[model samples]
Target: MSKLQNVFFPLLAVVAAFIVGAIVIAAVGDDPLFVYGLFFSSVFGTIDGLSYTLFYATPLIFTGLAVALAFHCGLLNIGAEGQLQVAAFVCAWIGFTFNLPGLLLVPMCMLGAVLAGAIWAGIPGLLKARFGSHEVINTIMMNFIAAGITSYLTQYFYREPGDPILQTKHIYEQAHIARIAKLLSPLGVDLPQRLPLNLSLLIALAAAGGTYFFLWHTRWGYDLRAVGANPAAAQYGGVNVARNIVLAMCISGALAGMVAIGEVQGYRYRYYEGFSAGYGFTGIAVALLGRNHPLGIVLAALLFGALQRAGLFIDIFTDRVSKDLTVILQATIILFVGCEELFRQLKRRWAKPA
Candidate 1:
């Protein structure tokens, strides 16, 4: 395929997915046009809608990058969900417990979250590297451990004092994120009060860029990529595959953890039960759809974010089709993407002279 063809792959996948979605819509007795119309409007109708989509896209960027990082090391990270939750809880605790100046407090809170996330993800990496354990099994089990530990911390250790709610106390005023709504108010846009977009969005973008530079430019990333592509060759080349695996997993976990910290610190300013809402798992799909490229991951996350932001509207406008259809769409996209290499090979064969 030419460069143009390579670039068109995602667009083609989206078109194919939508065609399948139309079939699903027909099967569910709804008008596909109306459903798609609702989707486009919800994502692009107004500045408010676009802001919501961007806000939703923020954490997805983190999780997608996390998964992409792990993929580069030939490791599948399925524990981002738990790592994010734990990091959020830790960041919230720091933000609330301290009263330092914003300059000092912000970095401290962020550092706390990153460290916690890395540690949470690093354990499985260590086990896999040292003991030759399968990362998939170990990471899955570690997710359970993270969940339990976070649940306990939230329930007892970090629960707000004298509050009936099962959530932490609000962070310091200075720690609260500046909302995009505040910025849009000057432009005469009346955004809904429901969704919150914060400064962490900038952080996520920076992380995405950093991920790209690291993967494509740095020597360390080269080593990690070498290991990912061929472990035996990398080992023979003395690249320390074990160390790279653990480090890559830690980086991936840190990104996931940053999602929660960004969300809570910028929006809620508190840790609550069910704060994540399955972002980690969705990130796997996003990474796959993006082909593990930093830019691709960002775009893929934006697509999913738009879909999620518009899902409720789809349900409201077309009651026949359930909101779960968005999930179905995401699952289908990932499944198809998984077979992308096969499709490429087939296309190559088809183009060959008879």
Candidate 2:
């Protein structure tokens, strides 16, 4: 595929999904243009809206990159959901239990999250490498295991006394990440104080940049990609295929773990039960739409983040259309992108040979 096709294909998929969405809106007795305007405005019109979009995008960015990294290694890491859950729990556990100063506690919590996620994901990776088991099955099983274990642990050990909620105690203040609103107050940009946008956004961006560098510019990345392209060939060429497989998953899990920084430390300040809201699964869509590139992932994450932020307004403003329309649109985009090969074949059949 050409560079133009790389950029054009995803954009075409997005436009096609929106076109279908507009038709659905019209069928529901609403003006498609008006509904779309409301959607766009709610996500991008004001500072609060944009901040919320960015806040939502932060986790998607991490999870998207995580999936992309594994995808590059010819692996489907469906366990990102589980990995992130475990990581969030570990991070929250550290935050609530530790009494260190801000500088010490924050990084320690992050490290805990990363290690927890890596270990959770590494099990499936090890299974795939050592036992020749399929990662997809193992990762899916791990998601369920992670969910059950985390729920049990939270209820048994961390639940606030007599509260009846499945969540940990509130984290210490020093462990909390500073919200971007507060950080910008000194610079005269008066963002909404309540918005969840935080320093984690910068961390997410840094992760993207680092991923691009690591994947395309480093020797280790080449070996990983080589293993993905052809494990037998890579091994014949002296690359350690098994090691790279495990390493790829470890790195993927670490990236997914970063989501906890935004959700647990930055916003909730607790490990709330079932707080994921499907960010990990949505990340697969984001990674596919982004073509597994860091820059593309950021843009795709922002688009999905905006859609999430807009869903509430769509529910309130439209008569017959519900927030479920966003789900439909997302599904449509995924369908179209996944069928790109079919479209390309049809295009080829219609074109003259050079």
Candidate 3:
């Protein structure tokens, strides 16, 4: 598909999703306009809402990029959930165990997080490459294994003495990333401290740029993309498909691990059980809606983040409509995007300019 169509279909999907959502609301006898107005207002009108939206967007950005990168390599990585869980645990472990100064400790924790995720994901990658196993099945099974292993480690070794929460001991302050509010306060932005938004957002933005450059500007990335586009042709042209598969999964997992930077270092400051709110699965939808493109992924993540924030507001402030609308909308969006083939005819008449 051309760039314009790549962008257009997702936008059309989003519009179609909201239309379906509005219909559902109207079917339930609530004014669709009232519900949607309230929802969008809550997401955009208040600083708290916007800040929280961006905070939530941080992880989605990471996970979305992870999924998108895998897509670029013709790989389906459903293992981001497991990859992130393992990485978060490792990050917390490094944080508390090392207790080094910020200059040293923070980077060490980040490196640990990335390596943990890479190793976890690389297992499935290796299995696929060497044994001809399906990555989807391996990755899904790995999620369960990761959850059990992380839970055991936290319960037996990392949990604070007698703590009721299924979480590890807090990382030292030196490991914590300053919240965006604190960082901005020195420059007079003065955002409320309650907002969990942090430097991870900047990291996400940089990741997007880096992903774009890697996928479009580099020889290695070109080989990976060629493999994804046509593995048989890629091999005929001297690209090593197996190595790229493993390498792509490792890179994808590394991106997924960046989620720990936000969750462990920015907000919770610990490896908390159930910290993720289906970020891995939601990322699949984000990547689809973004057409597996980095810039588009960032935009899609923001939209989902805003929708997430609006869903919470609907739960709290509305009596007739519920947060389930957001779920319905998201599902509809995915369904619509999956039907992009329906746009093929139009694209013949509207091909993107070179």
Candidate 4:
């Protein structure tokens, strides 16, 4: 496919998605214009709402990047959900238990989350590399394990004493995220001081650029891509396929871990049962929709984030449509994007030789 076609296809898919969404809205007797109006207001009507939406998008960027990175290496990292949970729990543990200055405490909590995520993802990688196990199976099962274990830890160990809910104690105030409205309090938002779009967003952006550089600009990245493209050929070319597989999973897991950074360090500043809400699963769609490009993943994450923000707004105004609309839209987009590679291949083959 030509470069123009490559770009055109995604735009077409988006237009199709909107048309479908409009049809659904009509069937439900909800006005699409009203839904869109609320969406616009929620996102841009007030600085506070926009702040929340972008803050929500921050962690998604990390998880999206995580899934995209693994997909590039031909690995199906179904474990991102579990990896993120473990990272969040670990970050909470460090945040609540450790007594350190703000500078050291913050970085330490982040480091702990990253390490936990790496370890969580590494388990499946090690299995796949050594035993030739299918990562799809191993990673999926690992996600369940991570969820169960993290829930148990949150309930038994991390749960804030005297609180009935399954949640951790608040992290030290020093570790709390800086809110944008609070930072610029003289210019107050109409609502309460909005949470700042955290440092994690910056970190996520950096990760994307860093991944792009590693994948397209570095020797190791070349080896990883070569292995992903064809393991037997890469092995023949002296790339250590086993080592690369493990490394890819580790890096992927680390990115997943950073998702917890946004949610825990920036948003909640604590861990809770069911805090993640299936970010890992959404990440798979993100990876496919992004064509596994780092920059593309950022865009995809924002799209999904916008849908989520809009979904909440839609729900507020209409009893007919639920937030599930956003999920359906996301699923539809993924289906189309997943088929895109096949379409591109067909186009390549159909083009006659000059």
Q: Candidate 1 residues 210-302, lDDT tens each?
A: 999998899999999999999999999989999999999999999998996568878888888788868999999889878788888889999
How large is the C-alpha RMSD of every model relative to the true structure? 2.5, 1.6, 3.0, 3.2
If scored against the real structure, what TM-score would every candidate get?
0.92, 0.97, 0.95, 0.91
Error of 3 at 249 (Å): 0.3
lDDT of 4 by residue, 56-133 (tens): 677777888888777777898988999999999999889998878889988898899999999999989999999999
Q: Number of clashing pairs, model 4?
A: 2
Question: Which residue pairs clash within candidate 3?
Answer: none
lDDT for 157 (candidate 2)? 90
> For model 3, how does the per-residue alpha-carbon lDDT over 1-354 read when each residue is reduced to its tens digit?
577777778998899899999899988878888888888898889999889899988899999999999999999999899999999999999998887899999999899999998999999999988998999999999999999999999999889999998999999999999899999998988788888999999999999999999999999899999989999999999999999999999999999999999999989999999999888888888899988889899999999998888998787777678988988888899898988776665666588753
What clash count does candidate 1 reach? 0
**Considering lDDT, where higher is better, how would the candidates rank from best to worst?**
2, 3, 1, 4
Q: Model 4, residue 354: what's the lDDT?
A: 42
By TM-score, who's the top model here?
2
Question: TM-score of model 4 relative to the true fold?
Answer: 0.91
Arrange candidates by TM-score, highest first: which order? 2, 3, 1, 4
The C-alpha local distance difference test score for the whole of candidate 4 amounts to 0.82
Name the regions of candidate 3 deviating beyond 4 angstroms.
343-354
Question: What lDDT does candidate 1 reach at residue 189?
Answer: 76
